[model samples]
Target: MSDKLTPEKRSWNMSRIKGMDTKIEVEVRKYLFSKGYRFRKNDKRYPGKPDIVLPKYHVAIFVHGCFWHRHEGCKDATTPKTRTEFWLEKFDKNVKNDQIKQEKLKEMGWKVIVIWECELKKDFQRIMDRLEQEFKK
Candidate 1:
């Protein structure tokens, strides 16, 4: 755990970590857009600022990074080698927040759709198909 990161480098790397508009986000959005599906990106009015919002279908899509959202059994979601306890607490809180947001959105009559980063990587076609079906319904 002796790895040293200068403040500038650490800040730069941390800054690159966005809550949205990630690689998977761009890919999913591109595919959906190509399929003629329109959505609002990161709608502010939504509880979680959903990555993609289709008011027409009353649906919201959240694309969660495996590590950030703690996708179980996902290799990409391994806890940090350092600050293990802190990361555990952070991940747990993130999951709790997600659940709360989903419940609130549902109560408000919105269909919530969550796509894991690993799912997108493992089977982009299947994920896209699911989204299409969801959007259709």
Candidate 2:
């Protein structure tokens, strides 16, 4: 099936999608900041360039989009109507890469935190609760 958008339009739309400081990322950052959490954003020294890196706490937080990350059991992770095959391949790769990053971080003695977009919209309080616990630990 042909793409509905013109090639130029499609390119423009894709370009507008940012690689960092996305909505969910910013939201998490703001919340963490308000709670007196100091963090570095997208620190390249770490695997996956995690959205927030709290060196003092040895914690790296990743704010992932459900669709892009293929969040398991998340409603927003559904495949797009178009380019089903391509999306599947892309999402599978994303999941695999995420796992590798997490493992590397763990091996390096860092605690990894992944907050999905769907969870942000639904169980935000739960996310905070868990973060608080992690911080205490």
Candidate 3:
């Protein structure tokens, strides 16, 4: 299938897509704050610059968009029909980078947590509850 928007328009739209401080990231931050958990947002010291870092618990949280991170078995992880090869390669790189970053963080003695966008939309409370439990461990 062809792209509906003009090349320029598509470029603009893609440019507007944020890398940090995204809506989902904000929501997760708010939840943690409300629960009295303090955290650092996108600390450059960490690999991948995790969305939320709770130094107190030595935990790093990544709130990932299923599409961008290529969440396996997720419907949102659909590929763009216009650039199948390009998108696939880009997504593959993202997945590999994520794994590398998470492994590095783990080796540094930090507990890593990945929160999918779909999980937040489907069950915000449940995901937050699980996050709290991780802190307790």
Candidate 4:
């Protein structure tokens, strides 16, 4: 096995992270709120506990981090030079889980909106438009 961050250090690093209410989450929430859209925050009752939930619109939003969610072509999604196998495995599992969650949410009749961290810079407006479309549907 490759050696980089020790198990203890990795645990600490991961532990310090927050799954929800992150910077991107806050920004998206604020933007949606500014547009007069109101919703729930991380309702565990839902399949993925979406970042923002518009139950009336049957829409669930997930603000995904590029690094964690492994967004393709994302600058923030660089793999570590060390412990390559471990990091790749972790990212692969994350991607798989995301797919499962989206499928489950869709099966429940919820329209899923995935906002990637990189997309936030270049496609924020497009994301909003898609969300609006979902609301209209």
Highest TM-score scorer: 3
lDDT (C-alpha) at residue 33 in model 2: 92
lDDT of each: 0.90, 0.90, 0.96, 0.88
Ranking by lDDT: 3, 2, 1, 4
Clashing pairs in 1: none
Stretches of candidate 3 off by over 4 Å are none
How close is every model to the real structure, measured as TM-score? 0.90, 0.91, 0.98, 0.84
Of 3 and 4, which scores higher on TM-score?
3
Q: In model 2, which range of ten residues has the least summed lDDT?
A: 74-83
* Worst 10-residue lDDT window, candidate 1: 1-10
Q: Which candidate is the best by lDDT?
A: 3
Off by over 4 Å in 1: 4-8
Worst 10 residues of 3 by lDDT: 79-88
Task: Give candidate 1's error at residue 44 in angstroms.
Answer: 0.8
The list of candidate 4 runs beyond 4 A from truth reads: 1-15
- Which TM-score value belongs to model 3? 0.98
